[model samples]
Target: MSISPVNCPNTDCYWSAHGIPDKYTEARAWHLAAHRAEEHGELLTAEQVAYATRAGHTLPNCARTAAAVAAAPEPIPARWDRTVILPEHPNGDLDGQTIVCCITDDGTKRPIGLFLDDEHREALGLLLVDPNGEDEEHATLLAEVQRLKTELAQAQEDIAFTERNTLPELRRTVEHHQDGKKRWRDRAQKAEARVAELEAERHTTNEALSDAAQQLRANSDRITELEAELTKYVGKEPTIAEEMEYLSGCLNAVRDLCDATEKQATRWEHPLPVPEWVETVRAATDGVRPDDPNDNRHRILVDGKGNGWISVCSDEGTEWVVPIQPAAHVEQDVRDVADETGSLREIGRCW
Candidate 1:
């Protein structure tokens, strides 16, 4: 059988411009023409579009001119033909004849007017047709049935095995997972409860600390107030140097009074009235008179009647006195002088 190559409708395509003989089959030419029209920007003629459509080739959005569509020829019907070499006649003559081929419903070619003798026709029929086609088909069907039966038996066994093993194992696995989930849920609940308890404890502790801080602040304020009251009552405590300065001033005052008294006694030529406490101090100091009055150590004593007496001491343990008489009207005691000065040191009461 000889099949002629179909020419591509698109002159730009390789099949039409440069392909070798037998390069494009009828279906291949129509497909390439449609592909060129769709993808390569090549336009097909209206007649080619109609022919490709009839040949079951689809061309999407293919470009065709309206004039071409109007001038398109009618669609030609498809035909199949074959040129066969004729056999020699029994009379030794070569007969020349063309065989007409027709397409069947299944798209196969059936040649009409093929002449053959009865013996040759029978021999050709025997060669073309399979003698054991029905037997082979039956054997194939039997093998297929046996295979299906074996598969069905295996499927039944698999179903039974799944029912016996896989289903129960799956159920146990699901139950185990469910139990684990429950245990985890319980643990999460317990942990949440513990966290809540800790939060409450922390809140309580914060409140307690706040109360303690407030109490400490109040105590500190009270301490400041008490210190202020103490300062008001006792005055500021003197440093050692300030106290020494005060005591030195008191000693100087007593010495001055003693010097004045001794000068008065020497000028008057009459014995001055000395308090009895001054006589006692003179007895205790052995009556040794000191030349430098400023160099002598003097202790000023105030009796209960507010009589101030200066007791003067020398290197020989001798004592001298200068009596300081209080006012005739006011009766002040030794403690009253101590309260007034704060620097006076009282050893004993002078009568």
Candidate 2:
């Protein structure tokens, strides 16, 4: 499965005039361009019209970059850079051989091409001679080749006919005539014109079909190439889908933890009136959440075991979770706050 790239030569067709766009120069893209030309009556550039080898395979003027890239040969090793035309090794079997070899500045030989031993050389000498009295067999083979070529041509014609007309339509055309003899005669001219139009349309349809089939094959080849390349990195890195799944799992775990903590925090019992210092600490530590309905205080979560945590935001715009301890811990903190005030006054004392 190989794709031969075609260049769109139409200077005015989409982006062809300025240059063969990188995207359009690809095998599939160019094949689609060809289909458009055949199926949609699109105009091609002058060079494409003039130089296309097939109905839709045209080479555009702007194909220089693509052509150069394609035409560039695979690099040969430096050792085989030089060639010698059958001069040094003047055996009859090697008469016209152009041997690739490494040649030093002073013309010392570094062998690269055929190096035949004496026995091998003798065998090749005998094998090169034509068999005696085989002229008739050669002539028969040539005729068979020509016959096969003719059969291939006929097969192509059959395929074109099959594409252009259905079997039933062909049978009807062969078996019936329209109206009476005179009526048929009168319609003959119009029938001929219609036939010509249909033939042209059929040709266009065939070209479009060929272009589409070629593009499909090219796409299949490209998909196979990509899949093969992907296999090379199968275990090296996680795919995007795998990464997303892992991240989603981590997020769900965090949400569950938050939910559990919230449940536990609500399980704790409290007296009707909270202490003044505790109220002051709650007011000071309450988070601001303008967008939340419960914006008056911190959002807290608890678990089944009565373990809980509070979610709060600091003035610096950072969010954190603080673990909830036993009520005694809170009472002690409240007393400490009261004692820190000057003269150790009542809960109403101002710092």
Candidate 3:
């Protein structure tokens, strides 16, 4: 098929230079109608409007379109001859015998009149006489096939575009999502481990607390025992340090008292006033001057009447009291000793 360039005479029309018109006159006539419809609102001829008004029928165009049609020139008619090559007959001997006539728009034929025999010519006349329906069917099928081929090419382009531009980006998006998922999984695992560790630490802390509570109870019981023992033995409650110090002090005081008593017994003395007679007897008797002057018998016996006496023996085996002067020096010495040992009374607290 050959394509001819069909253009609108009006450069302002949308179809002015676009190459889609199949026939020149048809495209030109359409553009002229479009111009009249747009610029003048003229679609019907004056005669058509009058006829519609008389018949009471509605028409789509105004009567002014008849003037546009009057100004536009009529398109020149052209003859178009469409041909199809028929297939050869399967019987090669009869291949050249068939004849096909050229089909016209009105379903008529003008034969080229080429014939090899009268028999073939008669057969073609009969066959080709059928009003061009077969030719139209063939053209319709050819147009359908062309449209399908164009659709197939467009589908292939779409497939190529998807493979080149869309698929890789989708793959990368999936990979990115997978990586994010992996990172979240790792974080979750770490969190789980941290939770377990905290639980274990809490358990250990609980055990330690249990042990401390037990030890506190034991300490409380021990304190109670110590307090009881203090009340039982010492007849009073006292702190252990205070009781130990008090007992140690008492032991020291008793030791001091014992030493004082031993010293006083070894050196017997008195700090009271001595009578004159007791001193006279001590000074007069040479034989009475004993080796130990601290003896109880040698100590002077003084009466409350300021008189002194010495125990004596007579020839009749009777005891006699003789008047004597007491020694004043020995009395003073005993007074000093008694004063030094006076703190012995404090030992009574031990009871």
Candidate 4:
């Protein structure tokens, strides 16, 4: 199908009904969350508010979403809404990862499993480590680091020299003038003023040196780390660079975006009311389907014991169920809801 410039990138959006609207919904939400996350200058995981459940907005949206799974006639429930609890990371340095989670209508955990990102596939390519590749890159960066270190050392020396020679001379002059008789009072005042000016310059110079020193250390460590990892991988497997390029080509092909856009646009499109037929298609079928995933079905008086049962299914299939109640008893409330949603008949059929 022709995807507009705006499209929801989530997999659920691939369903026929949502595909048309996915672009607007996905792009809008993505941009909104991304805009807020830009302040942190990092990617927001599901734990972040950007992707975490906004129950007020999300619950209602899911209720209306069409389940148009591809080529499947039985509309297996399609939902992205799920509660996820991540395991603690062993090292505090790494953040816990976001995992794909799903709760079945029956309130069971079913995770989405499959590798969608092709680069993660081991078949794409092997890590290429030429025995000599690391040696060359390591030598180059190490040489640059040494040159920077030398420059930093020189800057430090110049700063120290100025402090030792200039500061000490200024201090002695100021003290001498103050200790001398009245003739030297003016000279002492001038000498102390000069010392203050010199001290300010020294403070600024010290700060620059400190900053440069940190940058130099960081550069040196980075070079060393890169060299070590590269060397470790050498000759152990196919070259990583070679494998990466091959994988990239395979990814471009799987994308298969081609010209499907025009195909979808060609279809007649309009709002189809949430069909009451969907109820028959989806309603609980007992142990045949289990009264409801939520199992909320209860007994009350339509007039007396066993007269009523209600199966009001919600997002998490609670069943809205009543069990083992004989027809002698009645639930009046069940009658009210059955009169409303037409589920009371299903209860009568249960016996």
Candidate 5:
């Protein structure tokens, strides 16, 4: 828009105020602008609005800009940059249409409407056809696309790093390390079950042995009592009643002893299990309890041979079956004392 003011005949009157009123020139002359129709009732069509603006009578003030457009006499929006009458192409179709842009003439108060081919119009559609801007929207969109691409790349890199390094390590811990723990747990469970069975058998055997021992003690006492009675009777050259009573007492003692002997025989029939059953239990465990005290170490067994196993043992000497050796127990310390280190050094040298 140029600043050298031209004389406006209807000065401050938005319309041209001097053009012939036609189909497009709804109204003209000074401050008053009206959409006077060639026919009544219909608001001026957009085609009419453009035509009127170009004629310099309808919206003469708008040089494609609304304020400039409002300077026109007519009440029309500036969405219409301009309009063009279509011309027939050599192909005989009106397919190649011309779009007139209401380009503001820098030095003149007039709107310089220029023609655009169909292709240009399509491009203009992409760049808003109004205000006649180009590629501005696409430029904004392109920047957003670039930002998304950069973010996506970083995310993919993080994923790749995890797969190559962190994920593999995690998987190894889960699959191999954790699996080893499960195997140990299973072995421990088996050992425990065996120990329980052996313990039950041992309990029963001990109970029988105790009963036998009690019976034997009772029998011994009875025999002593009978001997005392016989001693007194022997001195008196014991009468028939005394002799008979002593004999009866001796016989009763023999009978009690016999019962005790039978019970003891049965009880002792199954001897205490050899250490191997315990060792087997331990060997079954491969006896390595690095975490417990030896005093807590215990052996369990079934009464019969080859029938028992060891449960948890405190002694590190025990062994258990495993694919790999059990991990050595580690002691956590904030720091090893210097004196302790010196002692260890001396021990190492001596050893």
Candidate 6:
């Protein structure tokens, strides 16, 4: 089925400025009209006007009125009830008259020139030109020329429409895509920078952890050496007297070594650490005397079991003795005070 092409009511529209041909489809006509309304400020339909109004867009005065007229149906011509009269040609030649006709709904002949204005009459005259005594081939060539002219005009109109309506929208679309791409690129650059920063931080942290691990290993080795030295000093349990004797020998050996090194003009760079047991023996033996009857004097003494005693004696015999509990070793300062004062008062105070 053939579709009737819709003519846009806006006389200023591109489609209306150009004539609609038989080949112009209904869909194409509406599409062009819609384009003209949107891009050219010439609304051709009632719906477009209403939409523009609701969207708070002001349309041109000409377009606002044209939309309503476009929505209304085309007026139907009144039927001719009386007999028609033919007008005389100005040239006074009936044979040369160019008559335009139309077939009504009832299949009766009607003069189309009655409805046309001067401009349309001139257009109809061109179309109705008589091909007097012209060959069939010449007529065919003329028809082809007319058809080509119509097609060329249609092509020019299509090009103009595209340039006016579609090109700007395409450019805007391209710009929008470019902006999106730029934003994404900026985000990517930031992400890359952040990743590099984190990587640098991780590298520094790894170096610190490696240094700590090396230091820990060195500390572990020092601890192991200290444990070995401790074990060598106190490998087995011994009596207090034997332990004291052994520490005394070690002290004499260290003193002899120092004396020999000094005599030879030698130096020792790193000295050995003194064992803790040496301090224990020194505390136990401080202000204590050896067992000797020949040297009769008042003194403090320590036994093998770490017990203490105060031996007070006259030139003739031992007078009094005070026993002290184990581990209560006497301080050398208190003994020196007792000896200097010729009294046991300081010693008693200490006890």
Q: Determine the C-alpha RMSD for candidate 3 after optimal superposition of all C-alphas.
A: 25.7
Give the per-residue lDDT of model 2 (tens digit) for 1-351: 332334355555442222223453443354444444543445454444434454334333223433445668964344434333333555423454433345333345445464445554444332223323357655575577689878975665455334323443544566665445667787997899999999999999999999999999999999999999999998889864466456445545655655455555556685234334443443332221234544446545332222344544444454444445544233222223323431111111111
Pull out the clashing pairs in model 6.
none
Query: Which candidate order results from sorting by lDDT in descending order?
Result: 6, 1, 3, 2, 5, 4
lDDT of each: 0.53, 0.47, 0.49, 0.43, 0.44, 0.54
RMSD of 5: 38.2
Give the lDDT of residue 36 in candidate 6. Answer: 61
Q: Between 1 and 4, whose TM-score is larger?
A: 1
Q: Distance (Å) between predicted and true CA of 331, model 4?
A: 97
Model 1 vs. true fold: TM: 0.32
Model 1: per-residue lDDT, tens digit, 109-195? Answer: 444444444454343332223434556655675577689878975665455434433543576789999999999999999999999
Better of 3 and 6 by TM-score: 6
Off by over 4 Å in 4: 1-183, 235-351
Clashes per model (N, Cα, C within 3 A): 2, 12, 9, 43, 17, 0
**What TM-score do all the candidates reach, one by one?**
0.32, 0.20, 0.28, 0.17, 0.24, 0.32
Can you give the lDDT of residue 238 in candidate 2?
Answer: 82
Give one digit per residue, the lDDT tens place, for model 4 in 1-351.
453333334545421121223434643354334333322233344433333355212211111112223333763353445333233434312233433344445455555522213333222112111223446565665577688878875665455435423543566689887667655777888899999999999999999999999999999999999999899888788654455446434433433322233334444476334434333433322112444435444422121222334443333423343433455333234435446643333423321
Q: Write the per-residue lDDT of candidate 5 for residues 1-351, one digit (tens) a residue.
A: 222221234445332222223332232221122212211122344555665556544332221433434566963233335454444544332655664646443444455444667766665553433444346686675577688878975665455334323543565578998899999999999999999999999999999999999999999999999999898878677664465456445545655555555555556668543333333333222223343333444333211111122333223543321111156233212113212322110000010
Q: In candidate 4, residue 347 scores what lDDT?
A: 26
Q: Is candidate 4 or candidate 6 better by TM-score?
A: 6
